[model samples]
Target: MADVLSLKQSILIYLERSGGLERLAEDCEPYNDPQRTEAVYRFNVSVHPSDVMEVDPELGDCLLHDPLTATTLFQSACFQVIKSLSLIGKLQTESQVNVILNYTHLPPFPEYTLDLCRFPRVHRPVRPVSMEGLVIAITRVTKYTQGARFLCTNDDCPSAGGFHHIRVHTPGATESAVVRNDFSCTNCRSPLTEDVKFRVLGGEIISGQQRTSTSESHCFVFLTRTDELCNSMRIGRRYRLLGIPAHVHKWPNIACSVEANRVQPWNKVSASFQRLLRETSSSLWRFSAVVAHCFGLHVAPPGSYNTLKLSLLLSLMQTTTDAEDTFHNVDLLVVTTDTLIVDRFKGSET
Candidate 1:
């Protein structure tokens, strides 16, 4: 409780010092939707560190990193800042809010396909609609041009095996060469070829639910995040991902991915669950996990990774004070997207 309070105070202080609401408004200038923007403005502004902290290392230097704070307040500053703009409809795409770079005002990305719906209430497969979930499995991958092949020109070099990441002068080599990291081969003295680099995350999501003793049959939820943040996903953590229900490829091998355009931590339990008392949604079982991490108190050696995942899911399941002790079911979400045509109708009605 104290930490969260302190975090909120730090957030308020940071925003005020950085330029407050008006400057934030300037950051939002890209979003041109007038009516939606106005209603969003009426929504209150509040900051919770867990929901806003920037954990990715690449973004660490973008804001002040107060090493003194045990949690490293520096990491989350940029995320919270960008979130402030997003809340007021100042920015359209949450893919990569450019706070680290200079404040160039590119027009807001026109909102297109974001559809919000009700996440599953029970442990059953919801029909594949455009939805969001906390990422359970994801991996970061870098794309290199297959053109980065290098073969020694030596006739008797013993081993003329091809290599990767070497710099070679191409067929149309007129300009001075880029530094070749590989040494001149002792056998052939040949250089390797080079090209640009690309990186992204590829993974599947089972609607972002952990396994339970009586878990329901899960469906394929393929999502991809193409940026530095793709690697930031933690196994037990939660994320609010946005994607459409679209099929790819053809026939028997055909697969479906969410085609994610937005990703953020899903801190507030689902919309329906939010109506419950605070104790029901959070805190009831949070102490044990916090204590385990803070004090490094392992009750027992976790037998396997699956066991650990099951334990984490178990920890999140706390019953409400009600007679039935209703479960707050925070496992998944129904995503929402606004249509431009619908927005126009809404605008005309207003």
Candidate 2:
């Protein structure tokens, strides 16, 4: 005779060989429309070839794979949590429960097709519908875009093989926009190409649609200081940014000015700024600092935010003034109705 198992043991045994139960358990919940859920689940199950086919002759055949299996795991986890809540008498009236997902694999386009439903519950449904009285459904139908491709190209290098970032938006939205990096190869001195093939945790590339090609024609003028350390009084200390077309709009809130018909001022100002901020840091910091500056200008993607902030703050320490006056001694104060006062006073007494 086979040994009889308790509910917890049975749940554990069922999920032992599958994906880690703790992680999947965080996704479980009550299925209002089991029929629709099962319908979609079955389709998902059949499509995934990775699911187990024939289990041991003693145990029954498994039901799901890939996405279906993922959903089942979510359900299992939900059940355990809900049951625990009920045991403690903390499970209040029905509410559409959702787990906060910090999905690292979220695609650029939106996912999850929504459907309206009416159910009686204290909390709103995950996907809500416009129905009068009784239950309100505010169900959040989350869809996963696991196979979306992520391509990264150096923002400064257009000739380098880019566009690996191209991803197809599902359910007919806009074509995928390019999200490239400002990274360059220190060894080859070429733009480092980061494609979807390189994943964060697991190296996996997914299928994505392709878009047509066109040269950006945008001349990226890098305004970097000369490789020389000099006092603020030195003339060549300022570098110049050249080759940018005249017809460009400089960002409104930035200190840099933009010329739309000529690239002369653009070049001069860029050079001056670079020369003024020049320092004797290693090449690594120089490269990182430049990328960091792009992030400050909002020219780089969101990923550069933290790096830019940190790098810029550190770069301030390297500022070389003829009077050797560091910014550390300066107290920047802001007064009412737009006035910035940089007060630098020596210690003690009037």
Candidate 3:
């Protein structure tokens, strides 16, 4: 209990020093009115592990090893700060307020980032980890119970009337497992009954795979924010995923899965190539012709097939930048009876 209190105090001090308390108070202003009917008041707080480390090294280490406990401490600290500021007007219950700690920036730890091939061998369960690979598959949107309120079944129990028992969804826990009805109350030793009205629902689950140059591994990724992330992901595209690795129990076997915290689009191009392209783009007049000449040099002489090469280059450019300019769309189709030259062209590197 002392350690928990110390951690909570450290979190509170970090929030105050980082100006998170002010942000929390401002975010809670909307629900300050007693007439508000919203059942849940969510406070989204962005946390930087480096910043936390600057304040308290032990707390920062705790945040990395035991993220769930750190998050709960952050929530408790935010609730205390908000209550002290009188921002939580009539919202006095634990079920009414939720604090979401978004770890936007993580410290540069070697264990935090792992290659797809090294993930299985090096990953620590329940700790934050990052992996980069192509997205091969995605699942449809599904409903999940984020949190549920349970009441003691015994009417004579002191905790029967209040929303005393609460179960929250955790990493590696299934939806059915969180809201399971066969729970015994601590006070009266009676079975708990779930109150459906107090149940909180979250967005969706996404599954994908991770691949490296040497090896490929099947990875199951779950994302909580569906509407924001689902539209941006495409099956053949590569992405960098920051999540927690866990062993999920299936019927017959336990499968390894990742609870994704953040999804980032991965760029395959090298920095030097990008820099060269940027430098070349500065000279707009001769850029297209130069690019086309270089693009077809591997397949044929630069000056021999200038027109065809230019057309192909223009089509590729248009396809890549189609989202930026919808009006100036160009499509190219090459027609020829020579199969040998076409085969050679197909074999050339892009």
Candidate 4:
């Protein structure tokens, strides 16, 4: 307890000295409106692990290994700073405020940075980890319990009337998993009933499979960040994600899922590939013909259906670079009655 308090104190000092408190205050200004009835306000704080290491090595290590506890302490420190700044009264009586620390700028931790295929063997539960893969699927936006208030059911209990036990959603926990009403009170040993009115909901995006190009291994990942951040991800795009790995219980077996803390789009084209493209820019037509001829030597004869093969290659390039908005998008509509040829082309494309 003493160490925790000291660590929290250190975090409070760091926030004050690093101008995190001032930024938090600025974030809360819009919520200060008396008529607003928001149940929760999330204040994102950008933190650089390198800076933290320079200031306090122990705290920095704690953030890397034990992120949940460290983030809780950071939240407590932010709340303390909020109260000291007299911004607490701006929120509703039942409102809960959260401080989200973004470690996006943190230098990669080599030991914890793992490949998708090695996830089953190398992953450490609840520890911060980083992985790179393509985003294959995404679910629609859903509501998750950010925080919930539970009241002791026993009327005669001393802790029943005055105090409310608040449960906040943590990484790896689901809304139903955290906000259930079967909790027993510590003071009176009474059942705690959830106060539905005080529940705070947040957006959730569940993405399926962080797949790699070289391996068949994959894992599920979900983003609990704000809606804007979650919605920014696109299918078929590769990304580097940093987060904690947790076991999700399936009926017969447990599967690993990453609770992504940060998502960054990764460039699929290698430096050598980019250089090759640049070198071939002047003789692009010749390069295209050569590439089409060599595209599928095993599935079809070389130089056969050169026009179709070149068109397919152009389609792929356009689709992959569509997000850049620099290239004109192409839509391919092949109208052919030759089923055998179509099948051969599809096999070659695959």
**Highest lDDT: which candidate?**
4
The predictions' CA RMSDs to the true structure, in order, are 24.8, 27.3, 10.4, 11.7
- Per-residue alpha-carbon lDDT of candidate 2 for residues 1-350, written as tens digits (9 for 90 to 100): 12322322333444445443444433333333343221111001111112222222112212211222233443344446556644212222121122211111111221211111212212322211111011111122223222233322444544233323322211112112222455444434564454544221111111111111133211111211111111111222222111111112234422221111101111133774566356524454674555455554544454556564654556555343334443344232222443332233324223
Q: Write the residue-wise lDDT of candidate 4 on 1-350 in tens digits.
A: 33777787778667777888788889878877877755566777777777777767788888877888778878777777677767857553322666666776556556677555554543465667777777788888888787776778888876464324667766777667768867988788899988788677778887765666564765655454454467767888788777776543332321456676677777767886578677778885766777798876886699898888877777776334235565464555565677787777763432
* Model 1 per-residue lDDT tens digits across residues 115-171: 322243222221112233444654444431112223454545532442322332111
Q: Which stretches in model 4 have alpha-carbon errors above 4 Å? A: 37-41, 90-95, 156-163, 213-219, 223-226, 249-255, 268-350
Could you estimate the TM-score for every candidate? 0.25, 0.19, 0.69, 0.69
What ordering of candidates by lDDT runs from best to worst? 4, 3, 1, 2
List the candidate 3 regions with Cα displacement exceeding 4 Å. Answer: 30-41, 119-123, 213-232, 249-255, 273-350
How many pairs collide in each candidate, listed in order?
A: 16, 20, 0, 0
Compose the digit string of candidate 3's lDDT tens values, residues 106-160: 6566778655455365246567777777877777777777777788889999768
Q: Candidate 1, residue 180: CA error in Å?
A: 28
**Superior by TM-score: candidate 1 or candidate 2:** 1
